[model samples]
Target: MEESSALPRISAVDLFCGAGGLTHGLVRSGITVRAGIDVDPACRYPYEANNSAEFIEKDVNELSAADLRPHFPDGDISLLAGCAPCQPFSTYSRAGRSKKRGLDWQLVNSFGGLIRDLQPTLVTMENVPQLADHPVFQEFLSTLAGYAVTWSIVECSKLGIPQTRRRLVLLASKLGHEGLAMPEALGSRRTVRQTIAKLPPLEAGQQYAADPLHIASSLSETNLRRIRASKPGGTWRDWDPELLAECHRKATGTTYPSVYGRMEWDAPAPTMTTQCFGYGNGRFGHPEQDRAISLREAAMIQTFPRRYKFVKNGDPVRFNTLGRLIGNAVPVRLGEVIGKTLIAHVSASRGATGAGSGNAQNTLF
Candidate 1:
């Protein structure tokens, strides 16, 4: 690690970089993301191709300090960002068992392990807000002994995300300065209308030719019929009694009518989930389109750039794969906010010590 006096070059090594959402945001914030690590091979093409960052198809637990050091050779001001698989913490999971199933909670501990081993200048993590109250989170925070830590449960809409998603973000730095707070909201929240209404109309399961971003996921015939009966922001109650599922006739099913509903044009979208492309799943219907939101629409609400490419020519585009990637991503806008906060902390530390050496061109929106 070189010890030049210049404001340290901010470089990041992203862990569990699903489809490069956080990496994209970090790049937008002017931070150089040298590499991204994820276990899913499906992430390899998009993560590397879209972000111009090296993609390592490896599990976080298999990563060694030696493997990561190469990406941060200078080690001036390195960032370790991880948003581990969230199935264990997700409210949508049907498994009532412990987090040991395919969705292991221990993965979050691995992130903590990496932070301890690398001792990077900064660390950031994003996950479902419920994680903030989890025991693992408490342990991870307690482990950051010398570092200043600041965190918040932020509503995605407040940060200009077009979905009503909430996530827990934690930022920490080894410098004595307190961790930086998230940026204030830019303006009033963006609604579904503001985000996607301008796009050309498409029937259920249709794709637009002019804009690849206008692609919509197809629906099953039954689901299509169900969607037609569904109202924006309304529930299964709006359906004909004959259309209701046996489960819906039960008290428990009736309690959660928001499922299989439509988004209100004027309101933020429901939280994007791994199943968001399925019209039968959650409130994923387009306000007026009578179909599930498209892959492009889901990406947009997740704060991805409209033109961000997800696949190369001729590559298969499966809804399950893309939906999982979009739902599991750290919204790019939120990533920018985190990146800017880190830059400010690092720059302020360098300035106070009169050791500024690197150019301060990094901008956080």
Candidate 2:
């Protein structure tokens, strides 16, 4: 192989780069992200607008090593981040396994195939913790035969993301140094108040004029009443018996207490889901507001900047689309932590200095 002629710097390609969350964090942490590839065209605008990286709309399964080589340039240290969509392996996915699950599981193999073919200097992957137990994960691991690998189930709250999400994080190095370790957890957990309290509040179904994404969904009369009765961090059990949904009154429904709940201002939020804007979805209702959290608030909990653009100037803000883009994104803070870990490992291996301070600050909207 010919030696790269460019100056030494970490350059990365993000797979499944929903709205550029991982790319933004990598850029923030001093890594040069060359491109973000995802099948969703909805991601292109935000991915390019926010990170200043090329957005390639292509399915990962259809991409070849040659298709990616042009993006890495000649001499930059190449890093590949493959954060496949995790819904197939997520606990939130349908209870029983099916052909659809089998199909999505192959995405992990496609990611592994890219690593095998490209053999980049560094590799990282993030997914739901449940994936670690699946055979697909073991098959993916087999692809890193020559690299030193380390993986752990990381708590997002410990990493300063104000959500109670746990994920599997893996780092692999082919540079003959120790595999990169996960960053140390922060001194304290961030809370809902700390992350989104300063934003302008909105009533149910109201939109903030200055920022379109700050709008909350309209609630039905019953849900409006349900949210009114909810206490911060409390479940449907706190609701007046008359206001209870039939499901909530049933034995099986009791298993789903977190639904129709309000997030506690003093605590981190529950995981944001694709349906997070709906008042009845998970514990997404605002602490004091009698409605589900706004799109902007949900993005902030996922660690996206308050002003992070989702919809374009004239486009409509479809709740389902925006919610999936934000909720499914790897938290920006978690991505930064992963980027810093890779930078440290590369710096150690090459006996060279790492880029920037790695203490990435949030950009204003």
Candidate 3:
């Protein structure tokens, strides 16, 4: 086996990089991310400020290989990585909808198109697990004709992330590596208490002066009372008849019991969604505090550093904007796993002929 110092140097570019979560992880695993590309101008500050990578603010569809080649340094192993938007493939999306519709699929095809044009030595992608069953994923797979490919549904908690997110991860190598795999599960699962119990407490409508992102959204008078009565890991069924919403009073409403609930301190948090800051959102209430989780807490659950800055100084912290960025981000811990796996795969394939010489799965935890 080759030593750590013997591993090939890798340079990468991130597509659809929101606030630089995946880039940050890859950097931690010793990959040089030259740039991140996205359409949202709002992502530029945090992406460049934290990741030390250039932020190209443009739609991915319009970008060509000529526009990207300059970023990759000569003689380095080239890597192309990103998480294209996956909301249309989400379980919450309309069921049984035709796979042939929407701009989301178009964005995914744009990614495949880049791979065809550039032919990077390595590639990685992350998205919702449901993407595995969609036709769009098969279409994306067809683009890698000469590459060896492997993919799986990765559980975030098993990777030491504090959230219960399951993602579809894909790895492909054009360098003749076989059976390239995702990283093995770590020692233990992280819990909500271990992740966020030490932050200063806040009321429903309060903001912490020390950390602006610690601000919680305001609750209505009835919501305040409802939260007070809510028990850890318990549902709104614990509420009194008068406190129940009109939806909850209906027979069909009982089906969605996870809404308006408190998180269990010992358990992993439910997946963070775009509306994660709202009290009425699914299982978002703090276990002890009488409010929803703050933006900092949400980012932390996604394995982002607490000091990760989403906005500039003097800029007002808006709940909707920050929530979307945090929720849509790839968990940084999972990204590290991808980076480690790729490093091991590339190292193991160095002397082999169209077959892997070692098991990369059990190598790193």
Candidate 4:
């Protein structure tokens, strides 16, 4: 197929950008991200290093319209995109606490506040699906009085993400009445084996020789023994009686088989979490390898391009930091789908009238 002409010159500011996954996808789909803001300083190096965008290390709450005014000065099709921290709405959060406080939830509301104040032409937010039911979500929708809003709980795999993750996506526009819908499911879901089966074999705690990004975390001797007993697509029940954890001996542990489990090569992988690099975290083990998935593998499964850089030379490689960046990001492919949908909507709107209607298309895939 012949390459299309240069994409539209629209600019965007990504809030709460974790290592630029969504930004990367938007760029690939032809949107120019001018700057990215996140509280985590670690995000600065990787995000700025990888994308053609500036990175701001500042808390969203501390920001005001003036701080963002320069980025959207043209008032043309300026876009605001964010994926706030989802711990507050996560099912994994501990249930029933007397003191109900969530800074993350506040941060999302602040994101809404930014939208209300900045009044960007296009706005998009992605979060864990449960957020769709939160009262705060309703308030967020209400806050966008002039903008047309559309949202959905979408399966990431349906958008070609190669994992079973799901998220709630909201897109609102200031120009006309339209809503953004999920993109059409791509071909058969990409499988775990299809994603990483071809990499050179490495031992349980080994890093690849040629590629630094191909490094895998080391496994403890006890974990190594446990991995040896683990079976692909099987649970701890497959292990010898002596190898079982004390927790597993209890009734509650029986249902947690997805943990310390190997992936099935033929199926899509389980949702990649912040601790996915650890062997005992979840079903993060390699399909056939005796090790948990590597950082590169995790990024790839998160739909980051193989060439995407995550660290600078001489920087310490911290598993927690890297994992959080990978797990918390909007999958690059999903961002592309959102980007394309927005582009098509803008194009159609611009064609219908000489004005750029900021509305998003509502055609569900």
The candidate scoring highest on lDDT is 3
Worst 10 residues of 3 by lDDT: 352-361
Give a tens-digit lDDT track for model 2, residues 96-180.
Answer: 2122334687678999999999989889999989889889999999999999899999999998999998989999988865537
- Among residues 3 or more apart in sequence or in different chains, the pairs in candidate 2 whose N, CA or C atoms overlap within 3 Å are none
TM-score attained by model 2: 0.92
Candidate 3, residues 1-95: lDDT per residue as tens digits?
Answer: 75434555788999988888999888777678899998777788889878878999888888898898998888888999988886655534321
Q: What global local distance difference test value does model 4 have?
A: 0.78
Clash pairs (backbone) in predicted model 4: none
Name the candidate, 1 or 2, with the larger TM-score value. Answer: 2
Span of 10 residues, lowest total lDDT, candidate 4: 92-101
Point out where model 1 deviates above 4 Å: 1-6, 91-103, 210-213, 352-365
Please write out the lDDT profile of model 1 over residues 296-342, one tens digit for every residue. Answer: 89888888888778877666677777787887888888887777778
What stretches of model 2 exceed 4 Å from their correct place? 1-7, 91-102, 177-179, 356-365
**lDDT ranking, high to low:** 3, 2, 1, 4
TM-score of each prediction: 0.89, 0.92, 0.91, 0.89
Q: What do the candidate models score in CA lDDT, each in turn?
A: 0.79, 0.83, 0.84, 0.78
Q: Tell me the lDDT of model 1 at 5.
A: 47
> What's the alpha carbon RMSD for model 2?
4.1
